[model samples]
Target: MKTTFQHVNYYWDKKKEKDLKNDQIELFLYRSNILGKDLRITNYGGGNTSCKTIEKDPLTNEEVEVMWVKGSGGDIGTLTRQGIAGLYTKRLRDLKKVYKGLHDEDRMVSLFNHCIYDLNSKAPSIDTPLHGLLPFKHIDHLHPDALIAIAAAKDGEKIVKEIWGDTMGWVPWQRPGFDLALQLEKCLNDNPGIRGIVLGSHGLFTWGDTSYECYINSLEVIETASEYIHQKIKKNNTVFGGEKIQSLSKKERLEKAALLAPVLRGLCSSENQMIGHFTDNDAVMEFINSNDLLRLAPMGTSCPDHFLRTKIQPLVLDLETNEDISNTGDIVKKLTPSFEKYRQEYKEYYEQCKHKNSPAMRDPNPVIIIYPGIGMFSFAKNKQTARVASEFYINAINVMKGAEAISEYTSLPRQEAFDIEYWLLEEAKLQRMPKEKPLSRKIALVTGAGGGIGKAIADKLVKEGANVIFADIVENRLREATKSYNKDIGSYILCDVTKEEDIKNALNKTCLDYGGIDIVIHSAGLAISNPIEQTSREDWDTLQNVLVKGQFELIKQAVSVMRKQQLGGNIVSIASKNGLVSGPNNVGYGTAKAAQQHMVRLLAAELAKDKIRVNTVNPDGVIIGSKIWEGDWAEGRAKTYGIDVKDLPAHYAKRNLLNEIIYPEDIANGVFALVAILHKSTGNSINVDGGMASAFVR
Candidate 1:
């Protein structure tokens, strides 16, 4: 309830605007944007709005009364005129008689769609009947976190009556259907001049003669609710202190997170589907480290709407209390039983509430897992959904916290939760999701991803559906790279490969965000040319840090994660042609790479037993976009070979037998082959130099 109104940048398609405004749909869309962007009013997809209007009948030119209601599966903030379905007002209200004692969701939808006032309009919201039954020209319904804090309270009814006086109506919990609509209509009729209606364990509904009135009504109500909760928390002494202390400190949590993520990911991997976990943010850390987490987290989500994404309740683990927390075996042993207990408890709950022919119960596995001293993991069928679910719960945490502070948090009863979770209306919305991409749930961490070759490789992997972490020293570029990707598909960290602390923190971040790294593409290295006789000691050490020592450290950390999960993984090094066959002035580049190449082979020999494949993609003339070959360095290289800088690329390309000029994408393709398809291939060098016969080892 710290409220501020931010105007949305909007424009008019003059002709369309004039037409829509006359129908009241234009005002509906503009106000919807106002609500959608405000987090306190609605979180993501948890609200709806509508307007009563008139449209002309095409054939008769007769004015027809209609209700332009927000459609199913659309966010209130982003709703447009198309997103607002125009349903025949009287027709929709009259249809409630047919559905009166029925819980037939599919039948209800079919009838609703059939009564569209405009055939071209989008599907109306599932709660259209609720809005239609109301007498006002405009209606605003929202699951605002603050309002939910009041509605989901133990004595919610009493609190509402006290705060708003008898000017508000109270409707007890009823599944959203024709009955709920009828019950709401009855309540509003009984309380003649009510400002709003409060649905127990649900949300707020306000209506008015105009859009502006309804929007302001919602804001005032939310402010009152938020003020009540704020005072309650202050009185109870339950407000969150800034950054609470943890049993296992941040460093220790990162350490455990590195070990635990892969194991969880491995256990959750099977079939064509896989799951990744998101646990890196400050909100998750605060919740996990809090003292009352165990008691409060098990209480459930703020609303039943979250049941599908978060499960009935998260599985909680006390990692700090376990003996040998460092031993992943001990951690795994504890988690196995915890997961089973959660699964069994869910099954019992499902059986207790399921109707005789309810749809197949969702997988009993918990979607959210709370492990204090580490963090909470929100797992899902794909990376994007997993990420969205993670954010959804993070937002819910505040609402739950508010409810807990005001009164013992109250979620919908178990039977009501089951109805929403299994409703055919919701199930159809879920089924509409398109098929997963080939590499959909695979997690990859790519170093040097801010620019050049590393950027290209990262892009290719994303195209194949991998969730990628782009780690680079270029902070600005790295930030932009993460922004380009869907938040679920890509993220970044500023990293200096030569620094152990940088590498460690980056690894921990990847572990926390993605469960573990399936593919570690080591692309962080430099190319320098200096004669063996003239190479300075400083230059030698600098290049060596990047190529040899830095790569070794990365492998060391990655293997530790792979070993814990006991799942086979891939490590790829981007070595150069100079390593295989040193050119005249590439002593620094050649020496560092030779050591790095041999180190990859040695790692392959040792890690093969761990099912960790190690390989190299060596490209001789991938000069199209490689930053290593830019500027005076290329001129210097051309001078060494007694050729013009302009002709340098052709010289290297023809030196290869294939006569084709290789590109960064070609090199990426080779790396993709090794990591994605070459399961039995390890300790191998795949040359992407169009076929460099001289550099070819075979």
Candidate 2:
């Protein structure tokens, strides 16, 4: 029977499939990628797909049935041949002889390595037995929200029977291992000709003789479940017992989110500093403002994949529909107690559930926080992790909506969740991860980042693991500069630093984008070389507005955000050697640079109490890759020294004590050292000018 779906899309392309032709492995990858493309099908890094293929054994040159399945920690959407583990199917099935019982399921995982069909294959996932034991050429195990909704409902088994009848079978929740694999095999035998089975409180499994048929079967099951759930939802009068609080305007929501994110970030970073992501989308806003938010949020998520990324449950704040958003002081006063309570409860959970061999308790801070009438804030060790956590919660919210529409939503058992969370295998995996970079979890905002020294500094910060915001006045320049960097690690904003509103908006965006600001690099600058006699009032004022006043505005705004986080920050000003050494035809530019330099020292003393360090990096004659040396300034400086502009670099090098020519990268290195290396040396000035004696700070 032909069926249409409103909730899921048909992504199987006949043209694309034709290209794969008779390659069964390629067809399997095609089906897996198309299924993974939709979040409605499965979330990032969540499902596994497999195909049993007959291939020549590498050692014996004899044909053997081998199973290629998406491996551990692999995302099916981006799966490659290398990402799939190849296991001899007969060997895997033979493992049942050695499987002592349910208690020895984890040990069974170690034996799968012996079944390897390809020596270079990736490590198999825990779900290997679920696919390998099934008597089908193609199998799909997915965590679609629609299917998960039915699986997580209190009457999930009854609902599954009502939707698919005898065509789809049902199995009770069993942690993925040899035991669950055996249970699935039994379910298939008992159900006769069932097309699929719903794994209670987990996900769905479907299979067929071919990859195309398997893809279609998985979609038909998910689509039918979604239609049934949506029909029930339409009949219901209210979801989550209807909305309790009216959502704020989008602009107002963002304003409130910015105000709260830093404070929440600071509080959560008590153990380890966290990067945060904020979302006020319709799904998040609807759930947070619902009457049953308080009742439903603490029940936690049913899916293991969802909770692992989002934590067991989000910390929901108690706030009125029209809570005050003028300042964060009152909000902080209110949230502090709630945060402390959450930590205590988490500790108690560990104490109550700890096994003798359990790993030590980890950071107890909540990964997610729900602010009523506002939105959701998710935190993790990096930007991508934080962002993905927010997306997973949105999926959880959808599952809850669909389940609550028909039957009461049920969360995974607390003890069971604790077992999976603190599982020894999971702990070992965590330990295997590489150590974080020195600048990891740090967020930086660099002005004049479109090109030249600013671009260099921004690139350096990103390389060292900081999420950087490239702020510049030129849109095209900003776009070109940011196109090469990943969105999670780097982004750009239009900020004419001379404007207070621009500076304020940039800082607000930075906080909202990556949680909070840890480093501020003031590199946006301009130079006008002219004698005192030739310098006009407008020219002098222009230099002051951009160089001196621009630095003032950016720091004034960035400091507010940094203080809110209470996570001591760094501020480095790209000052000039011209500020210190007296030179002719440089009065306007020199005075502005001097002001920029002194401002660093003044702020250093003022902000030191808050642990906000301010410093300066002075550069002289940075001829190559410097926007300042592009036009009139270069010509004027060359003329003053009686040298051609082409020979200016050589002349400047000769003038310096070190006889070295400075470049933009050298200036960038200076900034990197001041922020990342010179943690204890703030209020200091480092000259990147190849050592000019007259310009030295003494």
lDDT of each: 0.77, 0.91
Model 2 TM: 0.97
Which one wins on TM-score? 2
Each model's TM-score? 0.87, 0.97
Q: After aligning candidate 1 to the native by TM-score, how far in Å is the CA of 384 from where it should be?
A: 4.7
lDDT of 1: 0.77
For candidate 2, give the lDDT.
0.91
Across 223-328, the per-residue lDDT of candidate 2 in tens digits comes to: 8999998899999978889988898888988888887789999889999999999999988888899989999999999999999899899999777646774566
